[model samples]
Target: MAQSVLHRDPRVDFFRGAAFIIILIAHIPSNWVAQWIPARFGFSDATEMFVFMSGFAAGIAFGGTYRTAGFWLGTARIYFRAWQVYVANLLLFFFVLVLMLAANAWLYADTDYVTQLALNYFLDDTGRALLGLFSMTYVPNFFDILPMYIVVLLMVPVFMALSRIHPLAGYAGCLVLYAANYVFIFELPAEVSPDRDFRAWFFNPFAWQLLFFTGFAMSMGYLKLPRFRWWLAALCLALIAVGVVYSRYGLWSWSDTLSDLRGQLVDLRCQNWRGDGADRCYFWTKSNLDVVRILHFLAIAYLVVWALKGRERVLTMGWAQPILQCGRQSLPVFMFSMILSRVYNVLMDQTERTTWEEIAFNVVAVANLIAIAYLLGWLKSNPWRPHKPARTPAPEAQGQAQGGARWGNAVPAPGSAE
Candidate 1:
């Protein structure tokens, strides 16, 4: 994909970091904070934001590799990053298992919530479950996102190659596969527990890939993110308002009895087929990348991009730097947060906490997440990567170096090596 150039963009980081935080809040079951996330107002939630930002970052990072080196090098870098994500997933799997087992042992040591948290397989059939975990077939309820990412990263080379030739062609392929998946219900295998049939992957890479590339392509300059328009924003917000009401009610099933005007809510049935309910309304489902979810996310992203256009500088301000730092170190922050959030989950479960206690727990967890981000940011400095080669020597030095041995009209002055 061809973005104008590789350069730091705080807007991306700012939102990326914000997405991680949103994911954390949402993942924590029963956390009141979850209600305020974008999902409450629209069909799409933090996951789209996370994946879009992932693709956006990837386009910038690997696009540079493709440009500086060549297609093969760029492809290799894509695989390498995929390998890293896979490794992180593996590490996370073990971490989750250990945390669950430890929590079980300490609390009650009697009844088990580890299974409640979806680790029954590990306890019942350790060997097969271990195999499934390694194969990425047995994803815990909350740990499936990484596997989706692993699949996406593995496909980046194909996206890059296609986009390099024709951006539309690449996205065309993604669109075809996504549509086919919806048509055929194509899915990667997943077995959360032995009792149930192997279920399809929750996120459906075949579908989510469309969103991923939409972001990558947008970032790569293949597709321009539409400039914010008042009509569009208002429409989006109006539809969002309808969604909010639907959420507040029971999908508007009760609206008919409300004795009030909720007619526009009916328009949400965008896929209504003749008189069929779906034809008239848009359904929002994450697995199939439903039109409602897709448009909701696009609208949200457009608003963010437009609103933050000239305000990028604020992300770096002291007040905003925590988010900026976390965004810059998204992967590590993400991994850390998942683990931390689980720990909080166990704590929430093991104790009878009051509302104040829950709020305090969330606050402390967020602070800890920020501190981890800070540490990750610091550790990422230089030592984690090989030192860059020094800049080319000056022309006069190059000439002298070519002369070798003794310098012109000069001899080795001391015992020190020349």
Candidate 2:
């Protein structure tokens, strides 16, 4: 009898789709009606979730490749993908620059010629072009992730080599790097001006690699220990409760008893601490990992995974399928979405920034995103291409059977070897 190829994990698709929805919805300005579910609960910042999941997905997709093809191949693949992203980003950057120039010319025709030229040259093209590529000093404009993605690609080989030793060891290294980021790098001198160091190190690929490693480690059976799921659920619930309490009651507020407790728990001085300072605020937003943020993100991730169990029918529904399709080809979808979002932002005037209008805009954005994803999926599943079975070596095949037995093949494995 021939073996059948198992289904790929729907959890990844569902989560990625959910992340897109969160990203879109979170960007909309909150209205009276929108306050029912706090944006913070859904997703206050979409970048972290996207980056973390990207790492996780890469781990699952690329780990076996690293094992079989060795580190160089794995590194090459990641770098190639990174290069693709960089090229796409550059294209978008130039496109946006041209659009900005045109918009300024048409909209601000009444302005003085010199003023218009300066605005076009300094603000529209030159400043933004520099900001987009290096992402060094300017505010984190759209498409900044391209540079960060390039950095992460460079580190993939290092991560692949480390992962082979022990998944936990790789995770430990990521954690140590994250901790160093908070202690040594995040804090800036109170008197000194903030510049590239503030933005670059805060968004440092080295520090943020922890979230990606966490995802990768989990996919590789690092979290497969007995009772681990239950423990994670419990921990997640507890942290959520704490987060709720912290949100409700200003834990760091000047109330007498609470202030004292907050002082003891977190050094207020840490906020002002520069290079040599030990005052570390637990909630500081660095591109690096913060303990609170990590826990918060993990709790949400666990909840999503737990909710996804035995829910394939729900995920495969009419509307749901489109999101899943987008999730399937996430990289292309992400790049496309970024381009569309930038274009939308540029075309819309300040009048469209109204709360209700923003909400409607997001709804349309998500709908179009889903449509794009579905179209891509349809294109990929071309009826013209006949399906073929993959060949496997006899010894390697036997090893798989034994390994499956060891793992107790309750869950169906995906069709691809990786």
Candidate 3:
């Protein structure tokens, strides 16, 4: 019922589905295929896609509620989802903690992924860490994104309220907040433990909110995708090519034919993109949501839309259907991918793998993920799934129910009798 609330959009689902798999591959640092993922060629990666898609989804799903139900009720529904996300995140925190501990004992004891995830505080100061987790202040590595989403969703009512008076009012605020964050390089201060020390949130809400609201505005018709002019198409293709090369060749562990050329671009990007603790090879930082990253995502999106403009059948094809299904079941599939990535990371750390081997592993991982998502999608579509019954309308109405009598006088049809 949750996923069914919105009018299904296949394109968004396909992109979301693809983003989850790409994210899984990217998260496993030990995998050679990580380099071949989209981030290397483009400034943006799966995070941008996921965030933007979520925003668009919110606009459609919650926006429908605003128009059909009441504004406050729709906003409340969105917040209800935020709570669901938070609860899921809490489960994930404990789940990852247990997985890491078991993995440490069972496989790579020396790896200590618990520390990498920032969960070691729980090991040393359980009481303090517990407080932080409950308060949404103690976010571990992959868990950080949920807190950001929860905070942003809390603002949807305010954003929608402001938009009613003036279209740009809420969006302008999003820009100013983003600019302030970039200039200050700030994150929501997070308490990792009971200690006085504070840590900045991994995904800066101020910066990320801009993208979310942008997607919302676009979906709601406050903004629209720029017209696909010839120049625009060219621009998108060129940028997509740049991203492809980096992902295909930029050094992670192996070198491809284009590595030399990609190496030069990375060097130029480092000087052009100034920052502290910078990694020259990575054109943009995931947390910062750099201009390049933003543009790259836009470019990729344009290309997808442009290419698939009239190609409706492509998504429905047997091979692509799994991805579309996964995209539709994004919340479950994302959680699945995250856990799977961690397990793969442990395996990669313990043994050596070649680029081809890593690619093969991803191939297998994807097949399994698709199977799981397909099954979940099937479950979601079950005829017996719980849902609210349709409300009966008032007796007085202009049109009859294809019968001679009005609603108040109508008798039940022969086969329809209860």
The TM-score values for the models, in the order shown, are: 0.82, 0.73, 0.79
Ranking by lDDT: 3, 1, 2
lDDT per residue, candidate 1, 1-418, as tens digits?
Answer: 0111112456667778888888877778777766677677666788988898788667655655566577898788788778888888888878877887888778653436576677776778888887888888887767789899889888888887787788677888888887676555666777846588877777778888888888767655667666568998898777676666656434656657532454554444443444543322222356667766787787767776677666666666888888877787877889988888888877876667677778888888888899998987677565768889754433223222221111111111111010
**Candidate 3, TM-score vs. the true structure?**
0.79
Q: Model 1 — TM-score against the truth? A: 0.82
Q: Which candidate gets the maximum TM-score versus the true structure?
A: 1
Selected candidate, larger TM-score, 1 vs 3: 1
Would you list the rank order by TM-score, best first?
A: 1, 3, 2
- Count residue pairs with overlapping backbones in model 1: 16
Kindly report which residue stretches of model 2 are placed more than 4 angstroms away from their true locations once superposed: 1-6, 27-39, 42-44, 106-139, 186-202, 223-234, 245-283, 346-355, 382-418
Query: What is the per-residue lDDT of model 3 for residues 93-164, given as tens digits with 9 covering 90 to 100?
Result: 789889999987888446788877767778888887788788977776678888888888888888888888
Per-residue lDDT of candidate 2, residues 91-114 (tens digit): 765665566566656653332322
Q: Report every candidate's CA lDDT.
A: 0.69, 0.55, 0.70
lDDT score of model 2?
0.55
